[model samples]
Target: MSAPGNPGAPGLAGNSGSPSDRAAQGRAARKRVPRSAHAGWVPSLDRPDPVAVLERQGRDRLPELLPIRYGRMSASPFAFLRGAAAVMATDLAARPHTGLTVQLCGDAHLLNFGLYASPERALLFDLNDFDETFPGPFEWDVKRLAASVVVAARENGHSETKAHRAAVEATAAYRTSMRRLSRLGELAVWYERLDADTLLPLVRSTRHRRRAQSTLTRARRRTSLQALGKLTEVVDGRRRIIQDPPLLEPAGVPDMAALRKIFSDYRSTLSEERRLLLDRYRFVDAARKVVGVGSVGTRCFIVLLAGRDADDPLFLQIKEARKSVLEEHLPSGPYIHPGHRVVAGQRLLQAASDIFLGWMSGPQGRAYYWRQLRDMKGSAEVAGMSPTELTTYARLCGTALARAHARSGDRIAIAAYLGGGDTFDHAIAEFARSYAVQTTTDHTTLGAAIAAGVVTAAPEV
Candidate 1:
């Protein structure tokens, strides 16, 4: 591993690197990787089969749940894009990069940015998913976020021109935010975060304000108590998770002993104080839960625990973590356990993370990470937004993404490369438009595979 860069040293941003020198380096990078190079999406001639990649991922997951994964991906182009992060990673390998590295969200789609509660119990807006996070070129994340705007806008019945405009505005916001962060002190940039007070004022439209308020309300209501009441029942004399077919089901008695050992191992990953606090809660039950379009087949377990009494409840979700999709295209790190890699990446990138977040190895040597099941977590409903609202949402996501990148990447170099212009924004907009088409084609191909009986796809719930 390489030594960390000193933010105040020579050759660094916010330091002795003169404005002219930085801008000249930025301009020089354009010559090496011109803006036009990012105009469209062309699958490399030797690109691997998309279906084959999906099948390979499924090998480590539950065999019975593979059909559900396929069905979820086949639902729409947007859904397919979510499940095909590995496919995008392969395609992005062929693109021109500025060699500026950041701890990437790897799958920085619009839906991935959301509102979640900080340890202080205050709501903060930030990147909430890190399953595919890795250190890589900053622009890869921007490309993914920009394309998601276009794909989601299309799914919401917007015109292509409007969708393209939203994507452009998002990239513009990212550029502007990067420049803003570049001028701040390193400590200031590190401390900057988008909390509720800082965020509500950014929404100028009444529609967006109402939507944001409603989302926050819903998130607060999604506590462990609510989950306990809705997902469990007292059967005979013991409390157990209610069965719900393919989505949720009990882990059964045979696995409980081993699961208890796994849970104990996870507690050891926490600090002494956190582990002591956790000891107050006794494990009640655990059940497998199918979650998200892309992760429907992965082993996700929601464990129920009680502190003091039955009413005092806590829920921890343990999700299997495989190697990040970016690992294939980017340089590998020292970490071998993918779960530990996720926990480290998340802690480094976010302003604050879940207090219970930790990692452990499970039966059969699978890596898994655990965190609170719900901590005022909420997302925007893209299907129900106007074009103006969509654009505003896009800009907010861009801003949050920029803040994350600034905390971990060479912000001065990235800001200078982006410059105070719309050239890079327009290039990303064009790439979003082109990639949206490619995603649709890939979704169609998967649907054809299901129809041909080569892959079975269960009906979506």
Candidate 2:
């Protein structure tokens, strides 16, 4: 780690480094890692089998839920991409990086960039997932976002031309956004955010504007108060989380006792004010939950809390946090605790985070993080998006991603590396189109393994 006032430190986006110095460093990086070198994808001869990679991840996860993970990944190319971040980590490690560090989202796909309520209760669009977040090359995340755009475009039955164009525009948006941020002061950059209400004009079409408005409206109604009616019911005059087999179920007695201990410890990590706010609620019920395509099989629980009365409820999720899949490929990050790594990375990268966010060691010393299960959170449906709609959403995600990276990385350097032209954008778009093909092949392999009984996959619910 560099000294506190060191101007040349890797991640000093603005505080210590002179504007010209950081900008020059970014320009120098382009020579070592040419913008054109980022194009295309060719699997190395010894590339790890994608299914085997997933199997290894399942070793420490719940065996019963492993089938759900495999099942979800086998759904479509876009679904496979969501679950295959570890596979992509190794692939990105194989390529040369420009060494511009950022607090990466690790899985910066289309679905991961969405509308979530800020601390001020204003709806903002930004990266919502940070399970694999670690400091590494900025372009790794850019490449992931670009690839997801192409995969989603293809899955929506769009032509290759449309997919390629969407990917290019997405990368271009990132580059342009970064260049704009490079001129801002430290505080201005840190305070930057995209208000969801103002995003309609950026969509540029009446149909897309309506769709954007609907997404924002849905997100606003996703608060805990709204969730109470959908996720809990009165049983014997007491509110309890409704049970749904496999997907949601009451925790075992032993697990329930352990969760109480975990929550108690997590509260200690919060600010005194947050702890006081939390004390107003009492733990009411807890249920194990299956969530997300890639996150299935991980130990996850949703705990219902009540304030004053049963009608006033709060839902918090405690998810087991293992070492990020990026750990093996990237250098050791600052955090030794996996749960701390997640919480810290999330705090640094997000525009505003959940007030209830905290972390603690679980039973058996396993790391886990806790946050609101749903706080005005909503993701766009990428399955049936038209080419134009996908392109617009892609651009939105790209801009959010750039804003996130700018917060932790040297925005001036990255902007300089991107230059005034579209060279890097075109390169990553080419890479996205090529990687989309690779993802399809890997998705098929998972399906083949399921058919051959090499792996079991539960039927989609």
Worst 10 residues of 1 by lDDT: 3-12
For candidate 2, report its TM-score. Answer: 0.97
Highest TM-score against the true fold, candidate: 2
The Cα error of candidate 2 at residue 322, in Å, is 1.0
Candidate 1's error at 278, in angstroms?
A: 0.6
Q: RMSD to native for every prediction?
A: 3.9, 3.2
Computed on alpha carbons, the lDDT of every model, listed in order, comes to 0.85, 0.90
Using lDDT as the measure, the top candidate is 2
In the range 230-321, model 1's lDDT, one tens digit per residue, is 88999987878899988998886756776898988899999999999999999999988998877877889899999999888899999999
- Residue 334 deviation, candidate 2, in Å? 0.6
Residue pairs with clashing backbones, model 1: none
